[model samples]
Target: MPGPPKSDATHKPPFETEELRQKLAEFLDMEVEVPGSKAKKKVGNFQFGIYAFFDYDKEPIYVGQTNEQIRTRIRRHLTNQRTDAVAMNVLDPFEVYQIEVWPLPELEGKDSKDAAAKKILNALEYQIFVKLREESSFKAVLNEKEPGKPDFEVEIPHSYKGIVVSDEVFAIRNHPDVRIARRASTLSRLAQIISERQVQRGLRNTLLTQATRLRALTERRLRGLEEKAKKQGAEPEE
Candidate 1:
């Protein structure tokens, strides 16, 4: 009774939604400044995915994902890192920052229960960015968020104990001292002196301990012999 599912000749492809775009941008740490009114405005037929870069000068400091409201997340990174003293090292306080975003095709309908939603979104994000950019673009998914980026704390162990004057700064000051010290010191002879001291200390300790034990044993044996002689003298003449 249904005539081929009533195909519509006027049907058109739907556009991506701002919510999805904003969410993707937020996660990617992208700074796409979509207006609040625009983001608030609702569309029934569309949803979008986006990836973005939080760049410091030409270098990207962080990447993230968003579906809608990319501005919020991007601004958060910018403001928080600059204003907060603690995050300064991670964000590099002295560097200037910038942000850019990649928009992807909108996903349709309720995606809450969609089993393959993340995979689908990743594929879409990757495809859209690749199409839009000449250079490679990264798309970070929310569910599959990027791995924790490591921040190695480089330190000269000796620096904590003393000020690190430049090697060149102190070079002239140490030149005369170094020459005098090296002329006065002999490495092989110093080793011989150390060996001699160690051997002397060891021998002294060994002799002292042995002498103390011997004195105690000798005194004990003499007391025992004296006791035996006293007992013999006290006994009957048998």
Candidate 2:
């Protein structure tokens, strides 16, 4: 008997996802100057770091720290969806347009379990948390748990920032109407999760932040659309 005929067309991944993957790879592979070092190092290779995710508007949405390689941790959050935040519906990978990382080059070889290393990491994370909080218009990030308070503040290292989405992807995802819809959907699901279970204050805080974000996006979108309609109405009929 003859075997079944093969399909003529080649199967391919979604264009947006493939483009995003390529751009994210490029961003991660970029090399940056390390403080006090003549040599430059890949940002992804850093074993200890603090990373933040920003939306299309350059608003910081989430922040995290990792003893694992920055590449591994970020890929987990964005590509794999294995992180607690993703699983809990507190974060939507689709919302992340840019990433900024502060690599701790001095902690490169230190053991993850070492107390000194932990202290430095904690201090660095706390510093980043405070910095992003100040920079954020909402005065909050999506992190469910705040970093441990450190007695002393550490000077943040030079940060490498880059957009992870391709132009094609950004053109679709950056539209005000599309963003408002996505934001509202995410906020609804998050609110549902909170209502269905007993949650912590931090989770409730996240819900509030999501609500605020959704409202702001919706208002902005409405304003722009109304302005366009008014301008069209004012024009003389051709």
Candidate 3:
């Protein structure tokens, strides 16, 4: 398999800001070396404060974030007695590897700390929550629709369409005769209602467009008349 494309450009971030520094600080505080390993001493300089995605049995799962050491966090996750034991079951100790570090903030105040951490985490490019199965994935389900129309109607739950006929208008139109006329009416009657409403809307939109044009023309004419009056040295009556 081909690896990712190689670019000639040297990789470097444009500039690091104060917020980034704070997140980096938190990141540096939480890394651990594999026990009884000769490389443990060498790994001490590694920082690990960010959230990471670890795969288990080749399936992408488990997301964790911590200001605490990564070794400690992984240990807790692997243990059965901890509060998040169910989450731990999915991860194999040998299979666990730090894929990426999601940065977090180091702040003094509680609210500020929480907000900063969230901000930095959100700034991460990947959808960490879904990749970790922390949130449900929004799959595009196939929808059935009437022929000749678009199949999918995007529905935003609880969004307001608009108020139909004003309360006063409905109240007056709700009278027996009006209701009877509308009820017994066939498709033609329904068509009449729709057509009339559409015609009214069209008329309104047309009038608005014409009014705008008229206003522009009127202003231009006024300016021309003013210029003419100025040349004749006559008082132009308003």
Candidate 4:
């Protein structure tokens, strides 16, 4: 018998890459950030899977996995609303503005996914946790008790790596009105503490120094943004 004929169409994958990405984004409940906009609309309920939070600087701050809805777990980390973050003080919702998630629908079956799928997710989470820990870019993993070793050998695909959300999502949070509100809150707390003499004499200077540094950073960032916005309105260079 002759060798099989060249199949131009069948040789390619069943689905195109962009189509796959769109499908994956939909499945994972991922949102694309719209530049210079505060308005947001929910995509879909996040499925059970691994998730990670990034800071304003796009550095991994936390790594976690959930057998339940990923959305529920993530909501507890929001700044204004939190479950245990406020009580623990390890993670500040204000600092956690970006999020990337990997939704595993395969794990949702009442019978549970096969052992291999579970193993891959577990090992993937472990690998990501190790990467974040080694980088030490953010404060720390807030809830992970330990970096559990991967129970199974699995390689995280380049395309399937954990998401690092863009910083644009923070535009609304950093708006001038929000900044003033935050300043007022900070002032109120400082006034109460100082009035009650809660700060020790030895620690007062240290507290003041940190406060001043934080204020300076905030001002610098605001000025930088303002200048950039202004430059955007200027004539283009020849």
Candidate 5:
């Protein structure tokens, strides 16, 4: 007799892409202490906050704010191609290895369209944007639009940061050569898009930022290979 019939449900193999999605889901579900409160909330449930994306090198690559749910906005940007940034090729989700989110628990239950709340959100986004820019090696991010300048400022909130990619995935994507090639390809595509259509200055700015990133990664890869060659030449052969 044949063995028990296979289950009706399809057995989905754990591909690296699926592994990444699972890891990202876990990261977003993580609970953290809410600022100025004893309550803990999932980082992704916050309705108003700023979030930043970091590359394999831990370099800040993109920053965004969401008046909607953080989970929804981030998923659209990463898991799908709905976001303008993703559609325009301004940001490649493959490059996002880590995520940092600032959840404004205080803004919970507030109306999404409330003017005061929007101002605070804008201020917070601008603050994080400036801070990230200052900390970045290239002094730039891939945002096509600059954060609005609100008349007032808000204190930056406590942030929850974590890598969303699994170790197995990281090992493959973290190589400098791999990153350089990916960056170069993205740059080429973005340049082509700009060349083919009438575009805004922001798109041009993104192109420039991509170029800078590609150059930096290429230089780093070249240095690593040269160092390896020199070390090998210095070793005595048995």
Candidate 6:
């Protein structure tokens, strides 16, 4: 089969901020290979950090944090345990091509270490979440979790206006890997729905009532995604 389009022109990012870009580059300096013959979890010994998952177009989809090591936390989402993302039908692992992390200063043996880091991480995640939710170009992001309340101030990237590049975003939508990942995600959701139904046998009426409301919300979100896609025109980025 033919491969993805070959272009001569250089790829340009929709947004760019010099300082933020530099920071991202530095954070992802080391390798965090996802799938290999041997299983590997955790990348660097980053104690406390905030990380983001970007799709094929370099658009941020999810933002999260860690208490001990950034790589270990991310490994959970990418590899074995993606329960949160899959349950919500938000993130499709195949779409994620790269991850960027911002390591926070780990204050060991300090009374305020855990508290301080938690506050900063929450604020940073929320800041990035709002930015992505408000972006004019992208469609739905996978951050279905509640936005963390801003407690402490931590700088987050806010501009995108130049050449931004990272892990290559594979354009091979029809690739076997992509199809398998997507199928697995679909099955996950199906399993959840089935399990919930089985357990709600005694509370069928209440389940139906809640399902109705949830369906309404899902429909609304679907329409929103459709509108966003239209606005993005041909070959819209998700």
List the global CA lDDT of all models.
0.35, 0.88, 0.35, 0.52, 0.88, 0.52
Against the correct fold, how does model 3 do in TM-score?
A: 0.26
Candidate 4 segments exceeding 4 Å error = 1-46, 79-82, 110-120, 136-140, 157-238
The predicted structure with the larger TM-score, 1 or 3, is 1
Name every residue pair that clashes in candidate 5: none
Worst 10 residues of 3 by lDDT: 138-147
Residue 185, candidate 1: C-alpha displacement in angstroms: 42
| Cα distance off (Å), candidate 1, residue 220 | 83
lDDT tens digits by residue: candidate 4, 1-238 = 9766677536555333333334434434645332234643232253446777764556565677765566566655552355543333334455554566665544455333556666767887887777775775332354425446875655543223333223343455556556445544544555455677654442344234335434655776677777777789954332
Candidate 3 C-alpha lDDT tens digits along 1-238 = 9666565353743222232233333433434343334333211132233343332112223445454443355345433326232221222222222334433223212342465444443333234434343331221100111112222332111100111133344455445344333323322333344455544343343233323333444565577778989999997758
Lowest-scoring 10 consecutive residues by lDDT in candidate 6? 158-167
TM-score of each: 0.27, 0.91, 0.26, 0.46, 0.91, 0.50
Instruction: Please tell me which model should have the higher TM-score, number 1 or number 6.
Output: 6
**Against the hidden true structure, what lDDT does model 6 obtain?**
0.52
RMSD of each: 34.4, 3.2, 27.5, 18.1, 4.0, 13.3
Which segments of model 5 are wrong by more than 4 Å? 1-14, 234-238
Indicate the residue-level lDDT of 134 in model 4.
70
Rank candidates, TM-score, best first.
Answer: 2, 5, 6, 4, 1, 3
How far residue 188's Cα lies from its native spot in candidate 5, in Å, is: 1.5
